[model samples]
Target: MTTFASSLKKEIARVARKELKDELGALRKASASYRTEIAALKRQVRELQVALRQTSRRADKALHTVAPDAPAESPKRGRRAVFSAERFKAQRERLGLTQKDMAAYLGTSTLSVWKWETGQVTPRARFLPAILGLRTTGKREVLQQLARGAGGATD
Candidate 1:
């Protein structure tokens, strides 16, 4: 009876040890899976931060162009203006002409010239030819083109 009891106790101890070993293996697998998930989350966070920065830059550019009250900074890269009111005004003034004189030369009203100078209005598509022609051919061809209904001149 003493030998049978001792053997039974040994069997129970062996079964408990095997169960504990299996539990430990399962815990280790869970821990490794959690670690992988954490690493993936960190990488996603970094990618989102980069996307946020790019979006912010584009927003800043859009705001600067649309808002006249925004602080003036140096021109951005790869931006070009086909026409500039300030440049036009400066060039006309340098040529010692008043708005009325320039308007008469360009075959437009003085009010239109004033609007162009003050940035209240921009040149129309039909007027672009006249403006460019004025710059190139000294305003004579501009009126001639308007008279002929050929509103724009070719480059």
Candidate 2:
């Protein structure tokens, strides 16, 4: 009777271990599948990020022109330069031009120039090209441009 009881206990233990192993094997397979899916998703995300960066660079290049005359090709859709009221005022002061002079240079009214300097209004998109055009001009070049606009002959 004692021998039969020991044999029964050992058989029960063996069966329990076999069942646990089967359960563990199934879990391991599912875990591997989940890991593979996660790795694939990570790879896809990396690829998408690279593609987005390339697209952004292309758009940025399109917005910025390389040549001086490139803005003339598309004045309405030319490179957009950043503008601020303080910067505008400072640039005008640095060029030693009065508000009226700046207005004349920008082909706008004196009131508009005042409004721009005072931050009463933002400059229109149509004026961005002209504003960017003058960013590189010196006081002498501005004077020359103003003179030319006043019907003075250019040398």
Candidate 3:
């Protein structure tokens, strides 16, 4: 009876060891595969870093070679809008744009448009083109343009 009990215990221990070895073998294979992937990613990162450095150097060289006063550059126009006072007032009323709304569209402060409407000031030359562009649009179109925020009601 003692021999039988000892032999049973030995068998159980052997089976457990075999199961643990198989599980550990699978884990070791997975770990090696992950290590290989990580190494490849590291190599790719090095290549990209080298490419970025080369690109930045080339851009710097190109910038240096460019003429300091190239025609590629243009003088920045002043912020000026030139619209008739009566026309501005009439259009704002027609398009249903309040002083605040007009400022929003014209990219000016509400006080500016208010003063412009009251004949105390005028729209800047820069804002003239945009306001003129708005001339072609109707009230509904203007509403849609203002609604160009995010996913709008019309959207």
Candidate 4:
């Protein structure tokens, strides 16, 4: 009787282990499938990011011009330079010009120049190029440009 009881216990244990292994086999295959799907999603995201970068470069290229009079300029940046009230004031000082002078050169009112310098308002997008254009020029060139707008010869 004792030997029969020991054999029955071993048989029950063996059956439970086989049942557990069979159940886990299906779950193991599912986990591997999920991992492969995640890897594919990650690869697609990387490809999309590369495409976005290339599109942005093409747009920037479009903004830059190649005029015969202008010559080939630095790579065209799609966005305009940031407006700094201090920078505007500094540019005027660098060229020994006043608010009225800056306004005349930019084809705006003196009050507008004062407001820009005080940070009460920003320059218009149309005026940004003219203001920034002053950065690359010297005192003589700036005077010439301003005088030309005034319809007179520069002093």
Please report, in order, the local distance difference test score of every candidate based on alpha carbons.
0.66, 0.74, 0.70, 0.74
lDDT of 4 by residue, 39-97 (tens): 99999999999999999976654443222244323225564456667667878899998
Per-candidate clashes come to 0, 0, 6, 0
Per-prediction CA RMSD (Å):
11.4, 10.3, 15.9, 10.7
Lowest summed lDDT across 10 adjacent residues in model 2 is found at 65-74
| Pairs of residues clashing in candidate 2 | none
Query: In angstroms, how far off is 92's CA in candidate 3?
Result: 0.6
RMSD of 1: 11.4
Tell me model 2's lDDT, rounded to 2 decimals: 0.74
Q: Which ten residues in a row have the lowest lDDT in candidate 1?
A: 72-81
Candidate 3, residues 1-155: lDDT per residue as tens digits?
99999999999999999999999999999999999999999999999999999999876545433343433221235422334566668888998878888776667778988887776655555665666676677888777766763211110
Task: State residue 72's C-alpha deviation in candidate 3, in Å.
Answer: 34
lDDT of 4: 0.74
Best of the two (1, 4) by lDDT: 4
| Residue range with the least summed lDDT across 10 consecutive positions in model 4 | 66-75
Q: Could you tell me the TM-score of candidate 2? A: 0.45
Q: Residue 13: error of model 3 in Å?
A: 99
- Identify the leading candidate in terms of TM-score: 4
